[model samples]
Target chain A: MGHLILRVTIKILFAPIILFAFYVQFHGDYGPGGGFQAGVILASAFILHALGFGLATCQKVIPPNWLPAGMALGVLIYAGTGIYTMLFGDNFLDYDVIQPDSHHHAGQHIGIIAVEIGVGLAVACTMLQIFYAFAGREPEPMDDAW
Target chain B: MMLAAAASAEVGSEVTPSTPEVVGFTGAFAVELCLLALLAATAVAMIRMRRLFGVAMLSGIYSLLSAAFFVALDAVDVAFTEAAVGAGMSTVLLLSGIALTAKVEMPVSRTRTIAPLIIVGVTAAALVYATIDMPGFGDANAPANAYVGRAYIEQTPSDIEVPNVVTAVLASYRGFDTFGETVVVFTAGLACLLLLGAGAIRGGGRNDDGEH
Candidate 1:
């Protein structure tokens, strides 16, 4: 009964929080935020969910198996972009040549976005993975104690 | 200082108001000082608090204050990261830790506390002394602003086409460093997973150290 309000509030908030994370993620090239901040923002949303809904419930939604795998996948995406640039006979991570005939760093735009997304995924999942390791080991504490 | 920022922003709206005014530090140094004072007070309170839970909360407040301080210095990106990671995520993580452990910190002996306090005081005094010689905020003639930092600010648009120079530098100019940092973060997470085992992966649930 005590959790009814928290559950409702989080339910209301969950979507917007995720949306804002992506906003921060993509908006970095133009604004004051980027992947690290956005990733933490995204992870906090889930962490908040885990707080309200209980670890087991949250784990069921996200699945613990995806955490470590997702972490490595993000790193791969980031490094893969770098490696892809290298394959094109360009210096590593030199975005200018990634798209041969593009005008004025169009390739750079593509590269930064891809790399940022990779960073976002890696950071978000790593944070969640760490949270699961910490929060998963124990049952929910007594509601009043919190 | 915040009051002045708000007032000036209002005045700015009255003029060429197409764009909102940047939160400038031109006349807001006092606000930064006040924020730093609040941060110091919060840190002191955190130390004095016996309950680990209370300390965690105070530390979160300290993070928030410092985030505001960062904003006053025109480091919006840093402030954003600090607010999210320091104030938001770390606070929640600390609480999760407290839930797993004891809420109250163990009381230390009076005599034992004195030695650490003296060490902390001396270190802080030294840091303060060092700060006295450091360049003032936004000092263009300072080494950073005068040299490579200025070059980055000048070259970013031409080199990367990113409006946010920090992002341009981080993802492009400093691409190798950012890649290394990502790898480092990935490695640390892997190490943690190896040691602790992701909750469900190890034991089924609570008290699931497996051997038990």
Candidate 2:
């Protein structure tokens, strides 16, 4: 964490990792990535930052207090999308009713993107929250000879 | 399902292999074989190593090797998940676990290993026997290939208008399952918070109890 090169490199990589996560998040409709992958990628950026700068600084950037709420909020968004569709008189998660004035294609696209973002948010927050729990436990300093 | 699709696609491409195609397939298979071998080696090393750090490193290597295998199978999405989750995130978690616990595994008694060995051996045998009943790798006439698989492939463009069928199926057709998965992840995060994370906030972040 005190190493200057590692800290500087992590600083450089942080933006790109989050950018890539977003790319994968939105590009799922066309490519081989989706919410889960994007979420993990996003979490990895924070984890890398934590490893380089220590947990306190990482938590300063993404406070632990918000993680649990964020996790729940993601699932709420997903379930809310389903509920919204159901309110339109369709079956649970049926996208055809999402945009009553438009064709099924547009509705499906919109619904899928919304749910994907929900998934990404939930997964990202959950991963970070779990990491915080693990990293928070203090360890006895070990000999570095190994 | 993704693995099945990839295997079938690979088989379909292999059917018309010119010299170049054959060479390419052969080279790919060779790479897969090497990766699998390395994966096995890493697993063995993990088991033999008493040092938790070495075991952690070996397990990360194992995950990376499996990620490579997933790529060889043309399951790029799965490979991405395995690389990120298995190799990347899990490694960090395991290292954190070691920081909380012992750096070396305690030596086990010979008698203590017998039951676990039998259980593992039986499970392995059962899995192998189950595979014997499965359709051959990439068989076009397999039940999955004959039914919903074909439907998804054929109807995705028309029905969902999504270029990625996996996304369409995950987010739309099987939306409930994904919702459940999200909830499960949320629950796990919450559980971790309640178990270990809550203490720090309650204790004003000092951890003065001297317990990990």
Interface RMSDs of all predictions?
2.7, 2.3
Error of 1 at B182 (Å): 1.2
For model 1, how many clashes? 0
Cα error of candidate 2 at position B100, Å: 0.9
lDDT tens string, model 1, A1-146? 22999999998999999999999999999999988889999999998898898877777788888888889988998999999999999998988877778767889989999999889999999888878877766645554576
TM-score of chain B of 2: 0.82
Which window of ten consecutive residues has the lowest lDDT sum in model 1 chain A? A137-146
lDDT of 2: 0.80
Which pairs of residues collide in candidate 1? none
Q: Write the per-residue lDDT of candidate 2 for residues A1-146, one digit (tens) a residue.
A: 75999999999999999999999999999998999999999999999999999988888878887887899899999999999998989988998787767765899999999999999999999998888888877774565545
TM-score, candidate 1, is 0.87
What is the C-alpha local distance difference test score of each model? Answer: 0.78, 0.80
User: How close to the true structure is residue B33 of candidate 1, measured as C-alpha lDDT?
Assistant: 51
- Once fitted onto the true fold, the runs of candidate 1 whose alpha carbons sit more than 4 angstroms away are A139-146, B1-27, B202-204, B207-212
